[model samples]
Target chain A: MQSLVIVAHGSHLNPESSAPTYDHADTIRATGAFDEVRTGFWKEEPHFREVLRTVEGDEIYVVPLFVSEGYFTEQVIPRELRLAGWDVSEWDSDGLSADQATLVAEDIDREVHYCGPVGTHRAMTDVIVRRAESVTDDPDVGEGFGLAVVGHGTERNENSAKAIEYHADRIAERDRFDEVKALYMDEDPEVDDLPEHFESDDVVLVPLFIADGYHTQEDIPEDVGLCEDHTEGYDVPETVDGTRIWYAGAVGTEPLMADVVLERAADAGADLGTALDDVRETTRVATGD
Target chain B: MAEPTSDATDEGEASGDAPETDPEAPEIDLPADAFDAVLDALDDRDPGEPLRFEGFSVERDDEGEYVLADGDSSTPLDERDLHEELSERAPAVTDWYAFERVVGEFGPRRAFLRWIEDADGETVATRYAALAEGIERAWGELKITATVTDRGERRYDVRHADDAGVPVDELEAHEDPLDARKLVTYDEKGRYRPLKTAPSLAGGWVFPDLGPRDLYETVETIYPATVANWHREREGGLDVTHWRETMERQSGIYGVVKTWDRGEGHEHVNWVAEACCDDSQCLKRREWEYDDETDLDVDGGDGAFPCREPCSVVVSAARKWTRLESEQPRTYEFDLTPSEKEQVEAIIDAVADGRIDEIREADTKEGANRYRTRFLRAKLFDDEGNLGGVPTEPDEE
Candidate 1:
């Protein structure tokens, strides 16, 4: 039997952080593509240590529902999953990218395939592009809009900025929008500097985050001058310093994310079984019908 | 059989060719396969003898083929028919090892299974029926329900006991057990809960359908190791590190706790237990004392789970109190009526018992009511906020 385990950084304070992981798991379970679909969190229940014990299938596919290939995806996840041959000591020296290749490990009796984060999947670019177009009512929304892809970047990990830049570059190459720029919450060219990078007065800020937690809801909105203080809901097309600022929700919250997760699992060599039809066939055979 | 003779005449009798028959040491053939192995375990019973084990009954037919049935049932069934029937009635009986693996061998799962099955007394069919109807049990702040699905698989539902009467649709549904971690982080008043086992968990959430493992994960997430620790205490294997030992092991910032040791007698430690380990403060029964030989005067609470040692919160608070106790004592004269002094004591008691929130603003008769306490502060305090217009520190004349 095959299983899919979606690993995400769940929050003990904000329930919204792990919402996408659960939503995607439910979507996958409905498909009946795998014998079992489960979720593991770094800061929550069925913690990384015990998540593996919950799996009954010998062949498992693990997909990290993170926005970037940074410390969590490369080091913490592999270490917590106890994936064989994962050396934490070599993390700094090797500078390994967990998304560079599919990590296959013989974890005791099971064969575990560690896939890349859903946010870094190539299909995520489409999700981001769709998010940029979602905030306005224009038939040709991208024709005069400047799309700013926002990411929670830190000097501690450059890969976070790289993921946003990669998506920004891909979106720009399509020339769907008038202008595309990458912005970060921590690094230079911060989200507040969105107007400085774009010539278009009509600018759209899309946070490349997994959920609408503090960053997407409070921090980004505050930084972009969309609100005076921390607020839950925001009205789009809010004017900021003469620039029409439109803010979209976090990219990971998009329903299309379910497809991206499956893509990540398939890329890591998971056999995407023919949905519930196979289950029905097996049941029929077992009952001699 | 030969009659035994005395040693003096036994040599001639032993050598005589009537094969020496020992009544006590008969060569009996051992059983083969699981079926016979079970019969062998029934001791002293002849083959084809009717047998009973809890819910199951076994008997031999006229052809000598073993037939099994429910203890309450009259129809005897062959092995194949029994497997088919039990696969629906009690899947655990058909696959006992698999069931055990799913429910786990330790902690609440073991206790829950035993409670439903009556610890080997109830029939498997009865146990399965009970599971189908669902057995609800309380684990700390959680109300857990264990049930068997149509497929005979065990499923669980976990919710705050306070929400037991609430409709499932009204409560937020969570699939991942991890959601409980977030649910228990704060109380109803939106204050952070420093102690997970405190009785102040918020309600209005339910994990409506969870596997046995997920149920364990959810309970563990909410209360950490309380289940395992409770089980360990039940099994008489709980290793408790009392206040004295736990204090001595502290280092750095917490190392000062050791200074307030047995030298001050167990009075201070008793106060510590009364303040921190009370059922009102925490939901764990304090198993630790001043030492293995010395027990504190304070009650250790009647919690379902045991606190094997002084938790970090207790130790940290002790360190602060140690520093405060080291200060030189000075008397500050405060003019107050006897009733005022009694009111001060009542305020402290109310706050200590966490009943401050329960006191309504309109309840002015209560000494610790919001308006009453405010009035007391207004009447007694000076601009510097000292009681009775007196300075806390000595005035440098």
Candidate 2:
């Protein structure tokens, strides 16, 4: 049997950070798919080094629960796991990045399959729709709203912005709303331009991130002028332009991504039919969905 | 022998044995009403767990009595009905300022409310991922999983097409059942026309698009077993043959390439392919035609776009495989002198019968990487007994 070690970029200040990854690992383990499903993080206890030593399995699969291929995926993760691939490259997307197969070391006694970041999968668009629909409250009013997909855009890489735009285009193609646009924290069509971007005053902004870290909690709400007090913003929406802007939690934290994780394993050759069935049964018992 | 030996009272309290005086509670406000008010506060705490107050405990019994326990002494505080007395001593919190101070007095609720105050709340993905997650788990119950097609259309592969929960049979009659794409029509301005009202197009074709709400409602109303179409199983695992057939018809971004290990010096050759890149306009998705015999693009695009670069997916994979063939150390198959080979074979045979974890316990060799310290450490072999090699894209129909 194989083991899966999901590596997440956790936060010390925020306890909620890295929560989704751990929750996902639990669901996958319950499916009885892999020999073991363990989670390790950079900021939290049972860090990567400790996790690597404790988890048991001959065939280990390490998946990064990040939105895009950037600093953490390329640098911090490899250094912590002590993976033996090129550390840096000319392009941020270059080198042993997420969503690909990379051998850890030449003579490691076990086979290690390193997978891509969770945020890049196209199926994620569905989760985004769920987030948007949740706070829409009134589907009648939502019919006239605009969707703004906000991301942590860096001036350095175009790939980050490309992912945001790609999802926005797909959501727009669905024609659920009157208008849809992709905006960024550090780039053009900034989130502050919300009122100007939409003809309908109502808007729904779903953060395209893996966790509700500093950015989703503080930066986004502050930019939208919807912060409740000095510090944090809840998943609930606030009014902007006299219209409600339903803010959703990060997209990467959803349970549907667990299926994607299994898909990653199956792509690397771990059979998951039995586990998938078991997991579905368990979920049915839990929610009757 | 002034007092008969009594089990109810602490024997050491000889001077304070009188029932008129109460036991010492925590030092603070001295009014008797305030103390009773604190006891009355037991109504707020959950009954399953006992709440400790200083050295004493306040808990609600299963019979609905608020019992205050001081060591072995148990007082049914609520049975005594002291709310009127306690209400007078407890601080009034009618105003906002008084309420703030009163809240400060609440140790556990304050902490809980503090967390609620600070919480950034759940992300949209979490709420929705849950919805999508439930659908996947209950796929058999729903009779279908609503999935996004490769072309990004949302549809379902109803378990029984004719007896589907949705009007799928009627919907499929207008469009190709195999294609599963919605029928859409455009108005003169090119805006999408509504299916319910749009006029017939050429050949009497009609716009029959289903909105997000309509599709979900229809599925909830009728579909029997909706399945999620995952990336690896792009066809929701229901139609593998057809899915594979479709994949084979399109251009792929990567192909398994055959290469020789020049560095290994064992006359080794291997077959490799690019990890399947799903980019719609993947660098390898060329319009140029490949030779049926050679499996390589023999002709430049006469009109269609052809593949250009080796691609990040292929280049990275190629780099990895090449490194594996060249670097570090070999564990599964290693070169040894003819004389030492027989002893190694004996060791290998001894370890083969048991599980890898158990066999690794008695061995004394340090592995070549960071992760080996935790693993049972064994190499996988194919049916032919050869060491397992690089992963290849799954076979198509």
Candidate 3:
């Protein structure tokens, strides 16, 4: 039997950090697809290093629960999950042909197969579209609202911007909203300037983040003029300057994210040459979507 | 005289016999409260254990009341209970003043506090720290654990995650699953092997050294640069297959330079490289490239050419340059032999252990240029090679 492990960069304080990743794992397991499914985190307990020892499978599929491909996804995860002492670049099918490979085997490293994060999947577009629609059902709300995919874009890296573009294009294709834009905490499209980009009476801004952290509660809202005005009654007016903007939950906040995780498992399993298509097909059939 | 002698003898015999002490009568006793007092002391000393004691009489009072005392008192005590009492007295949570005093009286210790919510004082729950300052202030109702002074520091397994007992399905669905990268396998020659670490790009992409390129691709993926599509020209470039073909055929520095450019509109490129003139070794040949307005600039000189003048002196200088230029932010991939990697790792360990001086002073054979440079730079030695102003200890402040 094969095992699938999903590694998340969970926050020590935020309960929602690993929510999406684990939720996905649960959904996959509910289908009785894989023999075992487990979780581990970098900032949280049972750390990234010890993840390998927690399972026993002929083949293991590792799917990173990261929003965008960044340093953690690239250098840190690979280094931490590297087979004992073996180099990641040189490992092969027949296995390591060097002293390092021998040392790794002797050390009892787990067989690992990693898949791309769920953020990169084309299917994820469906989640964003549905989220936008639920926020503003104003038949003209799609045109009146500007869709801002708020991401945690850092100044040091441009690769983080790729997810926003991927998501933006996906949402733009639906034609559900007039303006689909990308905004960052550190980089361009400052949250404050979002009000300037649209002529619409109201805007519905969706954050493409995975958890409700400082960005969701404090930064993103503060960036746009969503400050609570004590004088304007308790009602959070869904529109700004006749531009109605509704906030949707993070991508990881979706309850159905578990299905995406199952999709990742299927992808990883396929990569490892143990195709579990029948199990996934069953899910599609059962859901009858 | 004989009659009086018999009477005296009778009296003496009676006195010596002393009423042949009644066999059934008890000997001695004490204040009734004494028994209760001793039992109370035993109960106080050991609350959970069963109490056992015996009383003995030593003498009789004038009224025939016995004088008794507690003797052979052996109260079986529960050590675990006693230890618990000791632990409770020296709680982990204390005022800053008390904490300072504790550390001084005994030694430094790790103290943990269980946070209790306001609704139910008895219930403890983990809360996110809104700011770092909140941790230092007075905590909420807490259940603390701390070792007593003079005993030793106590080790605690801090439960860091939510124990509300999330269902296994919820756990796997949202959490980072276990060993997602199952890297367990070997070949005939015994080398560590990855299932597959190749780049599978969707759109057109081209670069040199596919191995390193793919590795960089993975690196780029792991650490993506979310460059906004400034041009707005949707999809004019070649698909991923053709771009990879271009990278495969390209060779020399110029080959990479020429092949990297995408036409004006929707033109986007990122470069990565590995070597340079800073080491003073790669003077033989310099590697460089120019496709679009890239952020690819050699650190030593304004343009790539002038900086890598004697680049020909260095072996594989052009290739190294290409790799460096191809990286996102002009990153370099030092092609160190495995032994070199091991050496660097050893130096890292030494520095970590506060033994930087050992590496700094080691002979040329043991401490190579790379090791020496890293140590000196890490130690913050001045340009003149003076260590006076440099910090010798690790920085905690």
The local lDDT score (0 to 100) that residue A264 gets in candidate 2 is: 62
| Candidate 2 overall lDDT versus native | 0.47
Between prediction 1 and prediction 3, the one with superior lDDT is 1
Report lDDT (CA) for all predictions: 0.69, 0.47, 0.41
Residues B96-209, candidate 2, lDDT per residue (tens digit)? Answer: 111133334322223222221121232212212222222221111112333322222223333321223445434333322212112222322343322111121111121134
Which candidate has the highest DockQ of all? Answer: 1
Deviating ranges (above 4 Å) for candidate 2: A86-98, A105-108, A137-142, A228-235, A274-289, B1-397
Report model 1's TM-score to 2 decimal places.
Answer: 0.61
> Residue B39 error for model 2, in Å?
64
Pick out the ten consecutive residues of candidate 1 chain B with the lowest summed lDDT.
B1-10
Worst-scoring 10-residue span by lDDT in model 3 chain B: B225-234
Q: Give the per-residue lDDT of model 3 (tens digit) for B191-306.
A: 32211111111111111112211222222121111000100111232111122232433333334543334444212221222233321211111223332233335433211111
Of candidates 3 and 1, the better by DockQ = 1
Residue B37 displacement (Å), model 3: 66
Between the candidate structures 1 and 2, which one is better when assessed by TM-score?
Answer: 1
Q: Write the candidate numbers in order of decreasing TM-score.
A: 1, 2, 3
